[model samples]
Target chain A: MNNSIMILIFIISTVAGYKLIKDVPSLLHTPLMSGMNAFSGITVVGAILTTASAAALHSKILGAIAIILAMINVVGGFYITDRMLGKFKSGLKDK
Target chain B: MELNIVNIVSLVIILICAADIKLMSSPKTALVGNRIGALSMLAAILFVLIYNDIITIPLLLVSLIIGAFIGILFTYKTGGVKIPQLVALFNGFGGGASLIVSFILLLEQGSNIDTFARFTAFSGAIVGGLTFSGSLIAAGKLEGIINQKPVTIKAHSMITSLLLIILLAIMIFGTVIDDYIVTFASGATVLSLLFGVIFAIRIGGADMPITISLLNSCSGLAASVCGFAVGDIILISLGAIVGASGLILTQIMCKAMNRSLWHILTGSTYRKVIDSSTETIVEIKSDGAKKEVHNYLEIVNKAKNIIIVPGYGMALSQAQEQVKLLFDYLIGKGKDVRFAIHPVAGRMPGHMNVLLAEVDIPYEYLCDIDTINPEFASTDVVIVVGACDVINPEAITAQGTPIYGMPILRVHEAKHVIVCNKDTKPGYSGVENSLYNKSNVTLLLGNAADTLAELISQLQNDLQSDTVLQD
Candidate 1:
């Protein structure tokens, strides 16, 4: 794909996301923020690519660190958000 | 064929994003939605690894296992009360990861990288650096490791502008000069990191939620640039979704506080020392006219319908358990009871809801400002538990107040009000709550847990005696 076309797609997708998320009640803002945090961990792709392509010792080390950090963001963010959402019981049963 | 597969994966990821957004709107399915979002992210990661044939199996497995183990441990061990700080730290990690990825990308490309790729890498580096450092400071403030007050450096705006200009000049010169590109990139990274700290530290505790959301957006923006640099469609789409959602969250937070983004950034919305001093005088005058009820138990027992407003103070005191006991007792007594939650209550967005939810407060019993505000008028008693600003009548009554025009719980509309707080000190915004001085208001001065415990014991004794008399 051309770089400009990719940029255009990025802008359109972002605007669409903005519209979709605009009406989220304040009750769920924390979850939304944390969910997005997990989503941002898509950088793990770049980290993996960098690690695989690394030719130098420095690049390898950096790649390793990036992968770990991004994974942590992804895993921790989702788990914590789930813990939070789990607490929002419908007043029916003790979970 | 490879391009077609990537395109299909990107479309699937976008569909996942849409599903997550829709699921997040409702409480019951939100958890499933969160899980689905996580699974999709995992699929994207696997797709990238497999399609690119970047199969350094040992290295990838080791790093992922270590990271996942630590993440699981951290998330599981940390109590719900510390969630805000945890979220902040996770955001910092995301930012740091993006920064590291961009740095490595830049190094690998060297001078042979295309201008577009170079520009994207530079942006990714700068934004990621800012998000990483800024989120750390935000976590510190929330944890009380750093001062919660806004730290004003004289001429901060001018200094920030100057630093930005210098960074731009370096980037431009580095691109043009080629030979000094590495040096310039390193310099820009350092400057960006400094800018993040400076920008974040000046925001008051009251505005921390908005700041966190903004930093989250920056991290997402950084990841999007990283995607562009690497030519990954899934990363780009996921990054854009997070970036856009985070930006909207920031706007929502600003709206909740009744302030513009610019006002928050320039640090003008924070109440200054002079303004606080003037506020003290107004508080004294209001205090003189107010009648403080000493017989809190008597008033509470007499009230038929009651509402409890929880805020940051409640979280600080860890009073949610006692609050639950009180609610149960009130319900047993046949009183109509409900909890009113402010949008920007506590240190982060949805902080109060999470706190109450942790204590098993039913979702139906918890009400937002709009739903609960009208009920306040018909309510016999209103308990302001460790909350000051959200219940402040000044938001509507007093013009020119720092918190003016902000939507509040309208607790003053109740026939009687009981304020349970540690002291008469103003709230996070440093603005005095005039609601404290109303004639119907009673100040219950003590820690929220202790005060609530006393109330619970008193109620329990009364119930026991009544049962004994009937027997």
Candidate 2:
């Protein structure tokens, strides 16, 4: 029953998410993605919270992996963001 | 679980955004984006609950109010700047978010990381990182911080191909070598970063809208990878939908400029811009056109249909409000005033729309280039405000010019043309206008803003004088 419920949630979330962004005008996608990036950071917190709360050995191990990947995601994402932002500064290469 | 306050807060924001979208008004500030984003997520969650048979009707109503307040706060704080910059800034966040989500999912999977999970995680991280960075560059360019030149070199072709191959090899071989994987992946990431920057530098500012759209597509793909990594069907589906659309836009932009996408990025195709050094030519045609231009004031009062064409000069003049003032006055007097918007007129996409919207002009008054071009044939007067290149007639006549075969505003089609150029100069394509020589076209040489203001103020006085004389 739980597995079925999970599956139903997954299917609905997929459809709902698709409905929201599927028709987003190409012009508006950048702002949409940028906003979502900030919000996506919440997932890292979610992983950490799961690690703290879960009692099962496998769950704990999964939580640890989630934490590490989350850290990498945040770090790599920010690094690239900063690098790209640097291009906009004056005295960079012409064009 | 029952629907709670957090869910409610999210729903209201989405409703507002939906309303805004239905009205076709883009959001201005990061805050509006935050609210709208919050709302979209809320709506998605609600849909999730309904699909799972989790929500009661009462819970949904309360959530809407909470979401609405948050949405209002978000929109209120950002001062609502709706432009390409806002879009780029938002996309950077989305790409970065997906990358993070995938990372968390990897950790959640722990030792149970299957082959599918590993593939998705790596793909998401790499693409997401690239999107996050690429978006920032685009934002910087739009924000007036980046170098706006095409960074071209002789060996760019060979270098790009080789680096891409190396990156692919690292992804395939490094996994077996386990310990070497991180190093290889990091190297690939670095190469990708340089590729993005160099690739961007090769495309000129005029092509930035296309670049922005392309980077957006990459971001979507990154999110899709994250979706697969986490088994999040929502992420995968939404990402794919947007990714396909972005790619189509890139294809269209490339075709418009008569260049393949790769040729545009490598800077190999347009070798002509480099061979030429442009110089200003000041030819004084002291003919009686200057005096004749001033005569336009006499007809201003009686003119029934007045069409205004705005350009970069008008943008530089920052006289959009004053232009609106002229229009408002005309409209008040029961005269028809319409805008002739050239597709590629301003520095960026929909630039004039943002400026005009800020001044509260009805969107209906603005007409596309093709729509307005035909109107000029029957129109009495076309008041061109501080524009240079897109309105030029030379593109149609001079096959030798780089802008040959490019369609432009048919300002020459009008019975009487009033052109306001800063000086005798070419536009973005570095070609002089052929319309200047036409007898019907009067060159009102001055700064666009001041000239337009003068015309409006002068017309008011003439109308007043005529009224008093009749009384």
Question: Among these predicted structures, which one has the highest lDDT?
Answer: 1
lDDT of 2 by residue, B18-72 (tens): 3422322233333344444444544554554455353553333333344334333
For model 1, residues A1-95, the per-residue Cα lDDT tens digits are 57987788789879888888887777778888888888888888888887888888888888888889899999999999999999888865632
The estimated TM-scores of all candidates read 0.94, 0.70
**Candidate 1 residue lDDT tens string, B260-354:** 99997777756574455645544335456766666667678778999999988899899999899888888878898899999888877778888
Question: Candidate 1, which segments miss by more than 4 Å at Cα?
Answer: A92-95, B1-3, B174-177, B269-271, B274-289, B294-296, B462-471
What interface RMSD does candidate 1 have? Answer: 1.5
lDDT of 2 by residue, A22-89 (tens): 44442333334433333332233334334444556665554554444333333333332222222222
Off by over 4 Å in 2: A1-95, B1-38, B43-82, B99-112, B174-179, B251-260, B268-277, B282-292, B465-471
Best candidate (score: TM-score): 1
Candidate 2 chain B minimal-lDDT segment of 10 residues: B20-29
Best-fitting candidate, scored by DockQ: 1
* Inter-residue clash pairs, candidate 1: none
